[model samples]
Every structure is written in C-alpha cells, then in structure tokens.
Target: MTPPDSQLPLGRRGLLAALGAAGLSASARPAPAAQRRLPLTAQTTEGPYYLDLALDRRDITEGLEGVPLDVRFTVCDTAGRPLPKLRVDLWHCDMQGRYSGFGEQGDDRAQSFEGKTFLRGSQRTDRAGIVSFGTVYPGWYAGRTTHIHFKVINGARAVLTSQFFLPDALSEFLYTQMPLYQRARMRDTLNSVDGIALKAGGTVLGAVREERQRYVATLALVVDPAAVPVIDRPPRPGGLPPGGPFPGSTPLSGARPPRPRALEGSARIRAMVPPRAEG
Candidate 1:
C-alpha cells in the first residue's frame, strides 16, 4: 500500500506534460545538465514548520537539545544514484522555528501533520539505498533559511516532496557575521539556474553542509516521472520464497543486477522549486 511519490503511472495528462515541458524562468537559469544519471526529486518544504501547530508535540521524538543533529540524507539518482526501498518521511522546525502539530490529535498520532508522519521516526532506504535521521540542527525561523521538511516515499504517491538547506556554514557564517543568510547561497543559487520545474534540470542536491561541517548530508533526489526505478528489490534475509532456493538464492541462472557501492563524498543540494505552485 505504498506508491504515491510523484504518483506517476503517467496519468493526469502525464503530470501536466511533465509539469509543462519547461523552458526556464523562475529566476535562476542553467539547468540542462541531466546528461545521463537519473532518479532525483530534489526535495524541499519545511519553512519554519509552516506554522500549523495548535498542539502536538512529544518533544518531537526527543529532538531539541541544540544541534544534536545526526542528519543523514540519501535519495539520489541523477547519475549520483542511491535509493534503497525509499520511504523517508520527516518533519521539522523545533529548535525554535515552531511547527509541532498535525491534526485530529488524540494520542498525538505521532505528532500528526496528516503527512510525512514522523515527529521523529520514518527512515528507511538503507543497504545503500540511504535514509538516515537523528536530526537536531534546525533553528532560524522568520523569513527562512536553515530548513528541513521531507517526504520522499517511493511507494505511497508523495513522489518527491522537498525542503533541505544548510550549505556553507550558513554561507561562511553569513559571509561574515550575517548578510541576510547570503541569499541562501550555494554557489549562486537558482536551484542552480532559474528552476521553475526541471526545464531540463538534474542534480538533485548532492549534499548540504554548514561547513562541510558534516552536520549530515546525502540529499540528491530528483523526480518527475522521467525515471524513478532503482529496483534491486532488496529484503531477502533468512529464508526465501520468491522462487524457492533461499540463501542468497539464484541458481536457475538469471538475476544479477545489484552492484553500485562505494560513495563517500557528501555536499550538494539544489532543490528549490516550492514557493507555492503545484498544479
């Protein structure tokens, strides 16, 4: 019962002609760089928690100490591939940004938000699929900058939600002390180039840092129906019933396609297309 990330069966007029076939004019402009690799949603969406809390907070799975963060992001595919089982649902804004509620609260239904259900717990995609969360670093609320609001489910029609910032130790400490967060700089933003909607973009944020600080990174998600199928079909430990012959099963001879490891770079995030426009 999970298949909505981008909900692409190619319906709804094929996602509005892939979000309008694009041309580039939101502002920044230089995308056309998805030469080969695929699978990136370039996600983002937690603006100071978007302030919708009336009451709903279990201390958010106990995360609000002060940068105690253990951030880990991994949902790549735009050449920098890495998407295992995919099911990362996160919620943010507590260091002081606010956001600590969802709806119909009763048992707090895990800090309801009606979506991304995770006051602090919804990470999968391991075994190299990548998806780790032990968050903390989230505080600048008012105007906006240091962010975190995810929803990358590869099985439940949320496609590639968004929100993920922190690139350059607040941009070299705000270019020195504080200069409007240096316009959320990351090598001159624009999602890399006037990102209205993948006019021809692909670089699903490789990683975002506070100083290559390693606060945590692995966010390289780009999605829009072009290609999102990293199927290794993992999850076969102890026993086997898919066709008999367990134990690393495979004797009928035909089924060998799971090899792509050894990635240790960290640093790259370019997912900005959400000011509020999703037809």
Candidate 2:
C-alpha cells in the first residue's frame, strides 16, 4: 500500500516548509528560467497500450493528419538545473485516438486498429536537457482526454513515468480542423476532470502555443536519474498477460506483482513533489 503524502520523505511536507519560510508567493515564483525544468513529473497509470517498438526517432507521425505539433520535453533536477544526456520515450494515440500496434482499445472495446505503429518513438536528451519530437496533436478516446505518455530511463533503471495533457480548447479546435478526427466521438473527460491531473496540482498539463502553422508544446519532466521508477515493475512487452490488468484496473487474484523498491530520501522528493505549474 502507498503511504500518505505526509509520511513520504521530501514529499509535499518539505515543499510546504520551504514555501512557509520563503516570503515568495506561488504565482510570483515561476518554475523555470529560460524553460524552467520542474522537479519530477507526476506518475500516472501506464495504461494497457505501452509497447516498446524499439523505434528511436524524433518524427513518429507516419503520415497522420491534424495540426502538426512539436513537443519539447526538458529533463531537470529538483534544484531547477537541467540534466543532459538522458533517454526519454514518448508515445500517444493518433489523430483518431487510436494507438499503434494495438488490435483494439477504449472503454467499450470498440476500436479494431491492429499492427499500426504511428506517433510513437524514443529519443535521448541533448546538452540542453531536452528531447524534441515532431508529431501531430493527439485526438481523444472514450474514457480519457487528450494526453501523451513518457518515460525517463538511466541505463536499466526506470526513474520516472508520467503523462502530459493538453487544454480542452486546443483539443476541441483540432477536432474541427480535421474531418477524420471528427469521427472520434468526444468523451466526457477533460483535463480538469482527470484525477491524476488534480493530484499532481496541474503540473501535468502541457504549456502549448501556436507557432506559424504548427503548435509547439513544452513541459519539463523532473526526475532523479538514480532513483528507481515508482512503478509495479519494468514495462513488459504487450503490457500484461491476456488476463493481466493495467495499473488502475482490478487485478486478478494472485496475479499482482510486488511494488518496485521503496524510494528513499529526496529520490522520494522527485517522485512525490509535483513541480509548480507554469504558464
């Protein structure tokens, strides 16, 4: 069982202490300087469609349609310093909210997209603590809103796993622009309605803007390169066995795996404390 936030070291409690002693207001102190890196992105459910395709490239969109989006993910430490030369893997649904390599997905299990690999790839961070991906804005599905998944790794140690969400207005705008996405029935879930977004204190939302014909979204994923990921175990091929479930799903009795190593000290800090949301 997960411990309460208070019991967790370098968690919200430590953040509160710093905020109390410092005379700065939350709104006044921004997270990053040029592109301020936040401390550890929030850990979300890996879902049922995370497959390491072994394709490492920046451009993952294999001839999809929608507003082209350039995603910039910056990795940094808790001190707001950038960490260079790290591996970051990113994946998301296509313009129609259908993931590649998955036969079917969604709440009602209505999709039949199989062996399709698009808008999913891996890249390593540069000297500036960033991994830029050239892809299109993702569409929505039945139960979840518009979002993307990412994982940061150091050697074999999985340090962090998280998701980034886009504003509803942007998602709504894209659906109207592309006729193909219009067929994907819009769900009731929005970023604000997502439980993980709320718990992470809105840090999970990507700061996006339009640049000429394409949209550029940027967000910092802070993590400790040395810390073990706060997941049940390393990501397995095709997610779990046939009956095995995702993180938030009901597990089959005696099928659940042991939790990953207990996070210690400020490693817990990077895993626990959500970065202050920035515009």
Candidate 3:
C-alpha cells in the first residue's frame, strides 16, 4: 500500500527530490522577490460542475480516451514556502466536452452521466507541497477555452478556487490532428478571447512539455492559506446562466464581454505559449 503524505520528508533537499520524481525540477522553485509576500494566485468562480466525490487517487481517467496528461501542482504560501497536507481537488471535461455525473453539458441537455466519475479526483500535498493527477487533455466547450478547474482546501475551508488554461497552440494542434478530439465544429474560444483566461492574466498558464507518450503540465500555486472562502450564489438548476458560467466583469464573475482587440498582442496572452525545453 502507498504511504500517507505525513510520512514524507519535507526538507529542501527532500522537496527537490520529490519534485524531480514528479517530472518537475528545482527550477520550478519560486524566485525571490523584493517583497516578503508574493501575490496570491488570482481567484475565479468554481463554475457549476464541482462535486466533492472524495476520491483519493492519482489516475482519474477511468479508461477514458485521449492524449495522456500528467497534471502537477505545487502549493505554497505567499512567502514562497511550501505548504504541505493541503487537499487539492481537480476536475475537467472529457474529450467531448462532457463532464461526468452531469446530465446537462454544453448544449446536450439529454445526455446523462449520473453516478459516473471520470477526470475528477483529489490528492493531499506531500511534504514537498505537491500533488499530481493522471488525466487526459481536456476538451473545449462553447464560450470557454480549454481549461482545468482546481481548488485548494485547508481542512473544511476552500482557500482557493481557480482554473488553469492549456496553451492554445498545443490545444489547436491536438484538436486538429488527433482523431479523438475531432468535433463537428472547431472550438469557439481561444485563450486570448476567453473571459476567465483574460481575467486570470498570465499566471493561469501551466508550463507544459512532452515526455515520451504523454505530456506534463506543471503549475505553481501561491496562495494565502488563511484566506476566507468567498461564497457565490448557486447556479440555476440544471445548468449555468445564459451568458456563461460566470456573469460579471468582476474578478470572480464569468462574464463574456466583447473581445478586446489588444488581448492577443498583450504580454499576458503571450505567456500562454508552451515554454521550450532547457538544454
């Protein structure tokens, strides 16, 4: 049987080793800033698809088909210190843009996935403040770019709720070339035009690279461990609101305002490109 997270080592050397085992390097460490506290990761609405299934496993695919993706997250405090023992929950839609356990997804109102679970799982951070999940590259839906939703929980309180985006070029390449991702029509949104992606700025982009048969995406999440969870009104039964999952111009709202002409040329959008491998 696998050991518990508390049994793991947490020193700097041990942390680096653990990170390396998870396909990350010491370079994944957060750089020192002039200020003592780093900016907390931007928060966003959790959308209408989250369900606390209490599943504790690394592979959430459950035999689903698509390009393999290994998702890794390292949780840290505002001071860049690793924070261990926190529970990280992750979920995303499958290759057809359908979420498990939801009868209504996108425009498919008759679809039924009730009692099913896939691409959804939870893991506790090891001493290295890292948790990893084995899932597939997510599919896109109307009004949103390709993204994955995650939450950081301290005990019973959810300290952070946000979504991270995949690089548009990688996503485009897969959707057009991979037979599993082919759809009747191409995705309607890109990272540059996604409202939530624009609101999240550059920090939401995960560092991605190919490893053998699968791809790995890594994200460093700096958070305020003591932050109080913000409660938003529940979505209307059966689906999200008409405009989108979120409905406002605010940081946490999911409003789909007019596309900005300069977003594609902005530094934030440019950061969504996948980084080249270091020699």
Query: Model 3 lDDT vs. the true structure?
Result: 0.72
TM-score between candidate 2 and the true structure: 0.69
- Compare the candidates by TM-score and give the number of the best one: 3
**Candidate 1, residue 216: lDDT:** 41
TM-scores vs. true structure, each candidate: 0.24, 0.69, 0.76
Backbone clashes under 3 angstroms, per model:
41, 2, 1
Candidate 2 accuracy as lDDT: 0.62
Summed over model 3, clashes come to: 1
Q: Best to worst by TM-score, what's the order?
A: 3, 2, 1
Q: Lowest-lDDT window of 10 residues in candidate 1?
A: 21-30
Residue-wise C-alpha lDDT for candidate 3, range 57-136, written one tens digit per residue: 99999988788889999899878888999999999998778888777664455677878899999999999799999998
Q: Which stretches of candidate 2 lie above 4 Å from their native place?
A: 1-38, 106-111, 232-279
Off by over 4 Å in 3: 1-28, 33-36, 233-279
Ranking by lDDT: 3, 2, 1
Clash count, predicted structure 1: 41
Give residue 102's error in model 2 in angstroms: 0.9
